[model samples]
Target chain A: MNLEILGYSFIQKGLIAGTAIAIICSLMGMFLVLRRYSLFGDALSHMAFGGISLGLFTGIYPLWTAFIVSVLGALGITKLRKSTKISGDAAIAVLLVSGLGIGVLLISATGGFKVDLFSFLFGSILLISTEDMLLILGISSGIIATLVALRKQLLHLTFDEEQAQVSGINTDKLNYVFVVLASITVITSMRLVGILLISALIVLPNITAIMFGKGFKKTIALSVSMSVISVVSGIILSYYLDLAPSGTIVMISVAMLVGTLLFKYVNVLGKSHVIQKLTSEA
Target chain B: MNVLEVSDVSIKYNGHLAVDKINFNVKEGDLLGIVGPNGAGKTTLFKAIIGLQNHSGKIKLFGYDEADYQPLLPLIGYVSQKVSFEPNFPATVSEVVSMGLIPEKKLRKGAVLLKNCGYSWNLLYKKVGKDSDKVLECLKTAGLESLKDRRIGDLSGGELQRVFIAKALVKDPVLLILDEPVTGVDADAQNKFYTVLRKINTENKITIVWSSHDLEAISKLANRVACMNRKLFFHGEKEEFFSNKELLKTYAESAMQMHMHDHN
Candidate 1:
């Protein structure tokens, strides 16, 4: 193992930012995927790209603009799905394409900094600065704290929304909170995983951990551990192999999901064989 | 005083009237069974009482105005008819029960609401299933104490229904609203479930309002009955519900209509 990379400040910053992102993504993503809103995160990430380009064009802070645009975009998606005849996935796709189109138009209008914009699209995890690190830490802490406080309510809502509302929970208001949190999670983690791959960080760890059949809290714990492992290992491998960190991280996540599926299959096969053997022996 | 009062309540969905000007009152400790054919708006009435649907008429809960019942929402527990989820929601029996005790706030108010629901400040910060007396009592009352650690998806239909009942009971609710509480349970299990509910009514004095298609079982248990088919056809004591020729005729005709509609 090339352990000497820890000496580099950029590596340290990348690790910190990656860890923060991994925690938030896994936690928030569990609820999203379970609610069948995985594409909502994807759409928000694309919208954040538009926000980033708008900020760059207007000469302001991109993260702030991305945060605002992503939140509004999420609300718009929610409203469109609720009010319009368009399907939920269709609504998401519409926003996704519009966002990408706007982002491209802005980039072309600016006519320079194509390299800088591409970094946001594909990510530049190794180039994380102290300011970026601080933003990640602050946003991650806020998201985690809010989730912890609303843990039981969120569980109730996720498990059975109608029951939650019937039990006097203000589900409409809670929904807004979920949208805002998801938007924040997508936008803040974009730098670590890139616009294209952010949803993978939010979704894959949760998909894998749910296969373990652990209870909700245990699933969340396992997902966070899995996400952090994939992120850290991917960063280290990328550093050594001179690969794209975002691509490497997403690939590692996909690998972990496949591994869990295979293990589940083998475990089922092993159990059935044991049962058959016992029956034959008897 | 009546535990619940619904006056001239009507519900419209997409310009179609589902429940029309229905009126009823439930006395405290009454096991009120609402019986109706399919699409007869029984569930809609329950939703109206739980404040889940918009209605034109007034609903009074324990003397609180309809709009003012938000603060008292914790006092009413509702079990849904449709138990739909991912089937991998990662929740245990006790965890689902704990959600009932989570208080209602406009946003992110789970902890604050839990504290207001009589949980001590210290207990609010602790992990779920810290063996609180209220949770244990509700579980024991609902016969789910033995399955507190069981994942919700792994439970049998009867046991799963009890878990939901336990979740509702944990709040010490004044009214327990159940929509088709025994839809998928076996016949034997349904009888046992009714027995448990009867005991809960007698021992805990929790007012129960349940919707069901099983008229015989409901008439056997419920002291009051509300018969409906898009409107209130009858509302009175169970004896009157059984003896009223006009009411019986209406129910029979509605049942025939439903059977024909299904075939068509």
Candidate 2:
């Protein structure tokens, strides 16, 4: 309610970055969720933790290392799933566990969970540096642009991968590109909700949107709106309540999901109940 | 005119030969039914033809060589076995069918895409109006015009098959390849599906090379039949395939083996 909060540059940056990442993650999440890789963001974010730890241990920029490790890790998961011998679910679990395992080991090596580790683990969106803001803006735009460009191909591939390939799509390349983009989205989203809960930002709104039983594009539209609303409101509330921005954002997302589910089932139950009563009267 | 030519095609799958040294040619407008029991490599052969699986062979489409099936893709429409995607994929019938046009529009008419929308995804969404009539025509052919706006998941297996068939037809492809499309469909849906398949073959004159478990359906529709159990059993006139008692026995044996495997 305080208009004075808008005057703080850090608050403005956090809100902008949060909204941007939400849009990117929600859009990316829609495609992944449809493809049945709903936890891919979660897996990649865990790898990003390991990636950041490696960066910190090696004295490299943590975000750059996070990007590198996450991309490679995502590609590995994709390759594993494609091999047929290894199931996609197993591949996801492997990467998810490996990332967290390595991250923990490296954290211990770095002499426990310091302020740096905690900052990335839970995020510091409210204190986003200008460079981080620029990075978020750049990454968000690039991701959105690429997704829109490949929309049809992605749609066809998502709907039916074999059919997409037979359509002369270099599906292999497209898939790799897709995973890379997903990795970028996961890594970029880390600043918003950190490694621990970035997947919530990526997947929650999309899941909620699906509960509406809308078409794919409509689902995406609904998801984006829900995500933006959650991010914007979560940020404002976080400022006023003196809570963590990331937790507030994800909490709002969880609230939206529960609310949508309630509305959906109640409407369904009400309709079916009416039908049952009418039949009994007849 | 040979619509499809496969020479010395062989596939090594899971450390064994799934399809071995297969050779066949499908002439223009020919309805060729590929029949085999489960694991007979009928699906494998289809996958090879459609470039889904790796194989060592020579494949020519429209007289063009293999490894460059890129140019020939727009001329071919492929529907794989069982589809088996998440039932909740969220694509409506029309949106999926409209996607069939993307390969054609991207491959054959690049300039139209450039002019319409710089970003091809926007172009697809924007060009939906332009392709609506065409999408409907394909749907009509598949008897799915009624389900145009329905979410594909809401449809039954038969209806879903028809949706994919409709999606394939949106390209107005010269070659239509379907793998076990009517399997798991009920008798009534099967009949309706056959009716659409017959219309496309006889009226539209689309060259179809399909793999199916239904030999009876193949006998009724396909002019040519290829019976296989890894290696080609017979590739000739449908009458020859049916009338040969010895060959029929071998085919029956493979079918029997499939049943055994299923039970196991």
lDDT by residue (A122-154, candidate 1, tens digit) is 888898889989988998999999999988788
- Docking quality of model 2: it rates as medium
TM-scores of all predicted structures: 0.92, 0.91
Deviating ranges (above 4 Å) for candidate 2: A2-4, A80-84, B68-70, B103-129
Mind giving the per-residue lDDT tens digits that candidate 2 earns over B50-139?
777889989887566765445656547787778867777777889888888854456554333223433221121224456888798788
Q: Give the number of the best model, judged by lDDT.
A: 2
Interface RMSD of each: 2.0, 1.5
Q: lDDT per residue, candidate 2, A1-282, as tens digits? A: 657988899989988998899899999999899888888888999999999999999899999999999899999888877876687778889999999998889988988887888889998888789989998999999999999999998988998887888887788899999999999998888888888998898789988988777788898899999999999899899888999989999999999999888988899999999999999999
Q: Ten residues in a row with the worst lDDT in model 2 chain A?
A: A80-89
TM-score of 1: 0.92
Model 1 pairs whose backbones collide: A216-B90
